[model samples]
Target: MNKLSDEKPNTSGVLSAAARDARMTFGDKAKDQLKEAIEIVNATAKGLGISVGSTATAMLDIHSVAFGSGSISLHDETGIPLRGMGTGSKRLLTAGLHKEASKSKSIALIDEIETGLEPHRIVRFLKSLGSKDAEPTMQVFATSHSPIALQELSFNQVFIVRHDKPGGKTSVLAAPSDAQGALRATSSSFLAKSVLVCEGKTEIGFVRGIDLFRVEVRDKESVDAAGVSLLDCDGGSETRPFERAASFQALGYRVAVFIDNDRPIPEAEATAFVERGGALFHWAEGQSIEDAIICSATGSIVLAILEAAERLNPDDFDLLDSKIKSASGGKLNFEDAKSFAEMDCLSSEQKAWIAKAAGGKKGWFKDIGRMEALAREVVGPRFEDFDEPFKKVLKSIIMWATR
Candidate 1:
């Protein structure tokens, strides 16, 4: 079977039928192939538990494997194209299968788990290695050069495969037990996505909050619950963060560096560094992630509520005005303040008016933990969650900014 498989394979990049036919392959066919791949991997690696299953292909346009000029994609059973899957989603599914097999005391194995994934998505893949719901009681092993994957997996879990120089024998090198040491050594080896450089705990706190609010976020529940590892590369200056990002990028992450706009280096220079060397995503102009939240009544919270109300009901500017007056201290325009001062500037009547217009008490400031929450309710019921809904807004912003 191996010989036949190798013989039939196209060695060169002549664009094999698999790539061309991938677009036409239906879900059932893809599922069978995936299942076969998983089974074969399982057979090769004993002890480590592995399982496989199929998910109903949702949107296939993203997954179609195209050959000619345009790209092709895989399709589902319905002849609909297969959709693209993220590293996180794929890992989740993979972990789920392994979990099920573990429940049945089955052996686990996976050949190439990094297929069809984005670099940013590797964090998710590494996180799934330690899933709590369906953990591999035995062992888990995979072959991947993805730095994100390496960084995300436990040091103990890492095994470097190499050929014995003299004997021509295959050998494996276990990563150092000391995590910091292993990470330091590996940082020089991989290409990281983005390095988040922050001032201190506060900066770390802010970045972490922002990450949570991100639409395509690393799954904290799975990562933390299952003991999946993540690198918290925190530092004060661009020097360390930049250094770490470079090191990790060399090892292989689409590295982005996150730093406060108020850091020592000029904002322009810092931004330029990030743009040129590292990919950095920061808070909206003059606004930090902390400002994203709206308090219930005091401070910037009301301003946030007012902003949401205004955006959703742009036609009712007068209504917004009245609410601003009611909430303001001296009937000031709620939009005047650059920050939360707008809330204090208004009177109670304006506050109540704006809140009432938004959907009454339950309408405006219903949830106050994050500003994204307020932004969503104002936008529409469709955007209930802050991250999912806010991501669309961010994408639009990115497009606009680039243009």
Candidate 2:
């Protein structure tokens, strides 16, 4: 968890005095004071959907001071402090405030939100911010290096601030694609952008993965620039991308569909989808989207893999041989399971070399860490602001591969 310090404490003495007064109060007077304090803090955090432990703790501390006591006693709707005070009273007091926050519609903005909180608490914080009753205008924004915080936000909401000089002026600004425009563009895609429907997560992952790679490899002047959004339809079942596209289109969105050519059902169904104003991409006989990825290696997979490799030790991911051999059910005799499938069939020695380079059983090429590291490196100094460029590259790869 990230440790967040107080916001320079406008006046420590004033805050300390406030705390003293609150701490000295007791009983009915104390309860009333703390309740009002809790309400004030909740109101202050309004419009920001997320809150960190520091914000919560700080507010509680202030309440403690306001009541002039060791702890602020909170009452439930029954007008009784939970469990009737003493020993477990502090804990009950904390719980009471939590219950109130949970029920409140105010958005939370915690500075250094991860500070002093465990993973579970952080997740809870995000959940509270994302509550069903959370006001539509409420949204959370926080700064932290914790993976948990990153996980809490969608890829689009993770903002990167950088310092740059253009036209002799140095300023701090959200990177080009990192701006609110890109975020809103991607976030509200179901209503705004074109929806390219695909079958499964891997398909969605591959497209998004490839697009992010292109954003890193190519420059802005290149064809088909970034800002494209990928939304997973969660398979061809009821919530499939096609269904999502249709729904979004009905609500006034320009939606398109892309599906695999798996046997009778997907192929036949895809044709009908295209006829209904959707776009289609079919995998060849017996080929799934993963295979399509291999087929489009030249324009798609290789670049992404290369980008990943560049970020770390490229020598780490030789899964080509094993994947192919596995795909062939051990019929093919290749040395390593870690070779690049795009590298045209290789000799046993080359495969062995790949396996050797791939090193551990988890193969570097398949590691998400390796991929992200490579993405950060290839995307370079400009990577901090990665949205626009990535979308462009992804679209080009799809267009090039499918073409």
Candidate 3:
């Protein structure tokens, strides 16, 4: 059995040692036999596109074999020395050597298998590490930070390592077979102790904002300190959120989902999720996070949102005013802004417009750091004054994360 590393090998010393060992075994005929064997090996290696020093002239005094090429060198694809080979080529060669050297009882440990390797080649590299039809039953353990690698492996073969900040602890969770695709799509979530599978960028921004507010204004721990990760699912696709949540749950993570009530979830799926002890947080019926915020927040918070919107997009004010007037059925007045329901019946377009105005893709929420800063200012000390529904949803997420 032999151990091979991706690190560059000392080719000259390795070949010299092999030559010395052959001399001890074969005695008088060793030199001729060793030279012949070297020529054959070099030719075969070259034919297979592998680089090897081509000559084996005897140098018994120094106990070394001289190469016909003058210096011992492993040539690359274009015939450059191994010393000049790129990282990918080096890694590929190292992996090949390890696979060839492995035996039935061998255990191979690799770090960052995706390093310097193209995404397309990762699958082939993994397959070569072991095979059911081969005599050498090799067992391999590898670490990777690439989603491409995850796509090549099943959930059961992948493990999530999560670090807990509060208690300073770490734990590993195995991925569930069913959520392989979702896990691969958002592989970074596996690094968090708790996961918040958000519907979209808006929800992600809102939660991050609240987490900032809690830390700066309320003097409470932030979500990051609690080891909670927020995963944006692009948007609340019919099955994306559920699939992601299920994948996290399968890994023994305390998973919570935050979505708008505008989209309906299948009853069977919802029941199964609850039965599995997953927490689901949704906005009010037919409402989104934007709608709930505007409807449930106090007069000051609503005013702040409007102010933020005006700063974000000055030209959209007239359009917003017209929409508000149409929804309110009259001129905008302080008295009419009592509740979300009373303010206006918001359409999806209106919700999107308001969200954009208050800092959607191009606004303060565009940069997570900026969003956290804005949240600190907008949220202020009156954290409890935030809309009840939004507050409740956030509370549920925080509770699950802390637990």
lDDT of model 2, residue 61: 37
lDDT of 1 by residue, 35-129 (tens): 66444333422222212223233122433344343342333335443233344454555564455455444545656656666665455444445
Ranking by TM-score: 3, 2, 1
Off by more than 4 A, model 1: 1-240, 266-276, 281-288, 291-301, 305-403
The prediction achieving the highest TM-score against the true structure is 3
What's the distance in Å from true for residue 326, model 1?
25
lDDT score for residue 369 of model 3:
55
lDDT of 2 by residue, 46-74 (tens): 32322322222222234343334435443
Q: lDDT (CA) for every model shown?
A: 0.43, 0.44, 0.63
State candidate 2's TM-score: 0.38
Q: Worst ten-residue run, lDDT, model 3?
A: 55-64
lDDT of 3: 0.63
* Cα RMSD to the true fold for all candidates: 18.8, 15.6, 11.4
Q: How accurate is candidate 2 locally (lDDT)?
A: 0.44
Global fold similarity of model 1 (TM-score):
0.29
TM-score of each: 0.29, 0.38, 0.60
TM-score of 3: 0.60
| Per-residue C-alpha lDDT of model 3 across residues 1-403, encoded as one tens digit per residue | 7887778879978887876665344433535755664454445444334444453223223233553433333332333445455565566656665665555467888899887778766765666565323454667788887767777676767887777799999998777777776766676677677788888766777777777677766688778888888887887466778778888887787788887776676667767777898788887786755566665666566656666655654576565555555554453422233244245454444444444343333443444454454456675445678766677776777677666
